[model samples]
Target: MRQSSAVFRMIAPLIAVGVLMVGCGPSPAPNSAPSLSPMPVPAQTAASDKPLRVAPAPSALTPPVGSLYKNPTNNRNELVLADVRHTAVIIGDSQAMPAGSWPQQGVAALGYKLHVAGMGGTGYVAGNGKTGNYIDALQRGDWVLPYGEPPLIVIEGGGNDATQHATDAQITSNADRLLAALKTRYPGSRLAMIGTLARGINNGGGRRTEVDALLGRIAAKHGVPFVSAGDWLTRYDAIGDLQDGVHLRPAGHAKIGVVLAQELTALGLAARPDSAPAAK
Candidate 1:
């Protein structure tokens, strides 16, 4: 009976240990409910739960101060005005570039800030190695257009076209494309053309004057205002103003600016009354 009792006690402890081990074993997965955690475990959200992102639209940049904006080849350029109500955009060749140019003087007199783009040897259909023609440059994004709707957009050039001997057909085609593009781009703006400056036939003018006249006809067809400087050298007796057979000196440009301003005023194309005149 004593031995039997001792054996029973030993077996009892073993059985208790086995029962405790079984109680501490891992539980099976649930069938219906998910396991609950006191602390949240960070899990990747579904794609739909994420906020949507979109790219920004393009917009114009305003300059804080008056300065020059140059392009890649330094062929195309802009004259930024710090505070301007009306802008006069001029696209041409060397004639439109330089400070105190006729276009610059005329626009300034009309109380508009000037934004001019031109290469030395480029025209409607003529391209220099560094830059393309006016239409080409505009299409290639060679120059940046000024922000807002310009009050006046002037197409200037044809000197290089004549010099390069581009056909009338080529000039007309390119000029038409450029005019169409400008009209489409700035539907609210007024369009005009400043013809090539040239002497009369008697004063050694040939292709240059012809191109100027041709441009006048194109402007008329498009119903755009045309200012002819074709006969200015001979008519105004300003041949002496010519630094070369073609280009004008600074004084000559200043004199021409006065005359051109007068002509623009006569055509009722001066700056709007709301436009603030640049400070002297």
Candidate 2:
């Protein structure tokens, strides 16, 4: 009996160890939770390495919406936000620079907007240091011409040419070029000339009057209507209205405006408020 009990004890220990080994082999315990691995992250795309697209700026060559245009009133360019019809283009010198100058006044009286292209010390054959002469300016696109056909295009300047003592040949050549360009570009528009504003022969008028008379003759040759202010300082008795030896004061501008308006009306050029506006 004692031998049997010892043998049984050894065999029972061996059986328990075998059972434990079986439970631990390639399988989890029945009462325990399962283990898990972390998920992997994706790699970045090549699209993220490319540059972003950016929009370009507006160009000056394209006079699009909100683009600026030449405004001679304050001698500054301003926004052109609306249509520009019924405007008379004036290419002149200091005489047409003012906002209330004779050309503007005359055009306004006729119910037309005045678009000036000339400036002080500029004429057909003369230019300010910063700008070219009238013909050169037109050719080089210095001035922003209005869209569509304007009713009237007036060439007004000779004071500078005369002041610089430009010969009649020089004046005529440049004037011819400018006139030809205007005629070609604005074939549908009427052309006119406003000669140099000056005093009479008896009122200290010198080269100014001579140039004015010369322009009148040129206008006749071109078949363009002319308004001579050669004797205006004397005719209107406006000698005292001269601010300097050349430029006029506000009162002088006003007087000349009225006179030009009347003359234009007589010539059937001024707008007739009572009737429909025509290009004649």
Candidate 3:
């Protein structure tokens, strides 16, 4: 009985240890739901809602400032705007040609004659070999007749100069020299310089403004008339008047020509036969 009791005591501790080991075994995976972290979201930006801004549309009539005028015809013909009844000379690049034509047509329609001495692709500065270049043409006496009374010499250029990247100083200097030369060569002739039309995308902006401003200064310096075509052309409205982003179409030419004639009449360069004279 005593032996049986001692054996029972040793067996009792082993059973207890076995039960403890069984209780401490890794717990089965919990049946409850699994834990998870929330996903992050990206922050919004103002640009997300809006489209990118674009530059304003280019004007149709105005060639981009500082744009080159490649002449459609390489010919260097001298256009004579001789109106004995209304004498005026129109000299310039292609823009000037068509724009000047408006005035010429107006004069003709009124039964008067006006001389247009415009050459296309011309520049005020010498040595750019596209005919009608103002510097070369002016130097050649194409617009002047020594024996006959000197007619008014209207000088229009600078578009090509701007395109050629002529510096501001160069433009200014060339204008001065041209004016001086005109005055010296034909003392009796009246001199006028026309400003550039509105420039388009082809003409880098700011540069045309620079050229126009310089033109104004030159006109002021010489105490001569400076016609601002940029303002007169109303380029925004008449953008369609241009053929290839620069030169004017026939219709565009007519519009500007009429405006030009009116301006000339106002300046006493042409006669307004129908309108009564303002009281001095």
**TM-score winner among the candidates?**
1
TM-score of each: 0.72, 0.70, 0.57
Q: Tell me the TM-score of model 2.
A: 0.70
RMSD values for the candidates in order, in angstroms, are 10.0, 14.2, 24.6
Worst lDDT run of 10 residues, candidate 3, spans 71-80
Q: Cα lDDT for residue 136, model 1?
A: 91
Ranking the candidates on lDDT from highest down gives 1, 2, 3
Show the colliding residue pairs in model 2.
Answer: none
Compared with the true structure, what per-residue lDDT tens digits does model 3 show for residues 95-155? 6555345545543443344556646666676334645356556556454322222345567
Model 1 misplaced stretches (Cα beyond 4 Å)? 1-49, 54-84, 275-280
Please give the lDDT score at residue 75 for candidate 3: 26
Off by over 4 Å in 2: 1-81, 272-280
